[model samples]
Structures are given as structure tokens and as C-alpha cells.
Target: MNHKPLRARRAPEVARAHILAAAETLLAQGGVDAVQMRAVARLAGITDAGVAHHFVDRHGLLTALIAYGGDKLRAMIDATVTDWLESEPDIGVLLAKLAGLYRQGYSGLAVALHAAGWRETGSPVLEKVVEALHAARFTSGVSAPDILHTRLVVAAFHHALATDPLFGTEFRRSAGISGSRDDGAALQLAWWISVTKRALGYDE
Candidate 1:
């Protein structure tokens, strides 16, 4: 086990960063359930109540984490857009990266926020985070509807590939999901290309 330093081992600023950093790391490693206050505090070299002082409770800490994660996702999507525009790369490679990037961490963030948003629907901070996400995605080169379609495809693909028993979307599973992830990604790209051809009058 990686032992965390005791609370007396660090300065105040360093200690705070440790807490946030530990929480963020745990969240990335194991999703929402990993974000225990005591665990974060221990990792940060602080008492559990010290963590609570920075955040009201588990919900408050989760809220802050969600905000941080949203910012990261927005940055990722923006970078992906720029990369796509610049290289105009093969759709298969792009789709594969898309599935992998969002699957590992971003979806966990989204799931956390969705639960928080449900509990405290009127929260201004949560509202802004979601609104910003929607605005960022919709305002990108892709139209709102197609962007949504893309998200649905990626999420469905990731969940199924992970053998996540709950997600019922069939667009991914219908491919019968065999061999390499590259192969699955190629299939997704084929689907996207068909959609594009249909939409753009490339196919008569």
C-alpha cells in the first residue's frame, strides 16, 4: 500500500493541494465511489474535517470536482476540434481516440454531476457547468444534433466495450464487437461516413 504522509508533514497550501489532488486522482482511478473524504484528507496530509472546511460535505467536494472535470473535458474537446481541423485525419483513428479518452474519465465526471444535479437541481454552479458543457459542444463546428449523435455513439461504444451491463444502446453492440478495438473503431467510422455521405449529398 502506498502510505500517505501524516498531516503534520506539510504546509497549509501544500496540504490543501494534496487533498484536491488526491481526490482528483482517486476520482480518475476509480470513479465517484473512490472520493471518500477521509481518504482524500489522509492522502493530502490533513484531517478529514480540514477537507470538510474546504468543502461543506461529500456533496460539496463532489461539486468542486465536477467543475474541475468539466473544465478538463471542455479543453479536451476543444483540442480535438483543433486537431481534427488541422490534420483532417482518418475518421477511424479519431473515433478510437474519442472512445478511449472520454471513456476513461470524462464519463465518470458526467455521471457524478448528473447525480449531483438531480439532488440539487437549482444549484447555480452545477447549472453553469452543464450549460457550459452544452454550449461548448454545440458551438463547436459540429451542429448540436450531430454532436449529440456523436456523443451517444461514443458513450454507447465505451460502455459496451467495458461490458458495462446497464447501457442499452445498440449502435455499438450491433457491430458484434470482435477482434481489435481498432476494428471496432473502423466500423464506427464507417457508420459516421455513411451518415456524412447521406447528409452531404456525396452519395446519389
Candidate 2:
């Protein structure tokens, strides 16, 4: 919805970005199954062949989208960290914002890509994205061990986002947690954030 209609010619990089954006919208709306090349082209205001030129096939487009989403995630994290530094927001509040952002912006798309990465046995772009994520998480004053622990906590948060929707009830039933799945997940996330802040000696 935010892109221009394709002209006779456009910058290749710009065109690819628009196509990927369309793909992401469709993916979020209808899951991976909904992201056909023709659908993406129609949404991006390009020809199916035009999209195919940029991405070889469905899997290729999905992979490229994974990388594109990684870049966006990094940008969002950078912005969040900047705001956190300036406002010195409470850790609970900050973590909640981050959780909401991840859940809404990245979780569904990431779930599909993560599955693809596993099926493929590895993905270079995915690995780099993950490494960049870990590097971005380092707090200035936190020790290595503390940073590692914080990463673990953050990983748990991400894992919950990826799995909770599908497995939440089963997980809670097995664990004997007495609450709605959403409520239980919220509590768990808050606890992890608290532990992460404590480990990092974050004053909030």
C-alpha cells in the first residue's frame, strides 16, 4: 500500500524492496501459502515476470524476504535502543514495547523463515542476521557473562513469540499453569525481562 506503481523502469533495488514489502503483507495476512509470485506482483504493481526476475521462485522470494525483515528488525532495534538511552525508560515498560513490536512485526514471518532454515539445514543470511542481533544486544557496561545471559533471556522471549500461538494451551496444560494462554505468556515474558535486567544490572 505504500509503494509506487512500477514504471517502464525503476531502480532494481527499489523495485525489489517494494515487492518484498508486498510479500510481507501477504505473508502476514495469509501466511506463507498466500505469498505467490503473481500475488506479490499484483500487490507491488509489477508483472509476475518482473517479480520472478528479482526472485527466482517462491522459496527464493521467501529467503530474500527473510533477509529484508532482518534488516528492518535491526533498524527497529537501533531505534528502540536510542529511545531507551534518551528516556531511560523503565525496563518493564521498555521490554513490553519491544515484545509488542516483535510479536506484531516479526514473529509470524520469522516463524516461517525459521522453519525454512531448519529444512534447508542452514542459511547464510539467517545466520548473519542472528549474529547481528546478538551483537546489537550488548549493553555498554554489562559484562560478557551478563550479556550472554541477557541474550538467553531475549532468545526465550523470541521463542515464546514463535511458539505460543500454536502450542500455548498444550504447553500450559502440560505444565499445569492455571490461566489463559495469553495471560501465562505475558507473565512469563515479564519474569524473563526482570531476570534479564537484574543480570545486566540495568537500573530501572
Q: Write the per-residue lDDT of candidate 2 for residues 62-174, one digit (tens) a residue.
A: 88887776667656765665675567545555666667765574666666656546232334323332343344345445445434555565666557656765566687788
**Local accuracy by lDDT, each model:** 0.56, 0.68
| Model 2: how far residue 138 lies from native, Å | 12
lDDT per residue for candidate 1 within 88-176, as digits (tens), equals: 43444444445555456555555654555523233332233233333444444435544444444444444543332123234356656
Top model number, TM-score: 2
lDDT of 1 at 107: 59
Provide C-alpha RMSD values for all models, in order.
7.9, 6.5
* TM-score, per-candidate, Cα-based: 0.54, 0.67
- RMSD of model 2 against the true structure: 6.5
Clashing pairs in 1: none
Candidate 1 lands at a TM-score of 0.54
TM-score of 2: 0.67
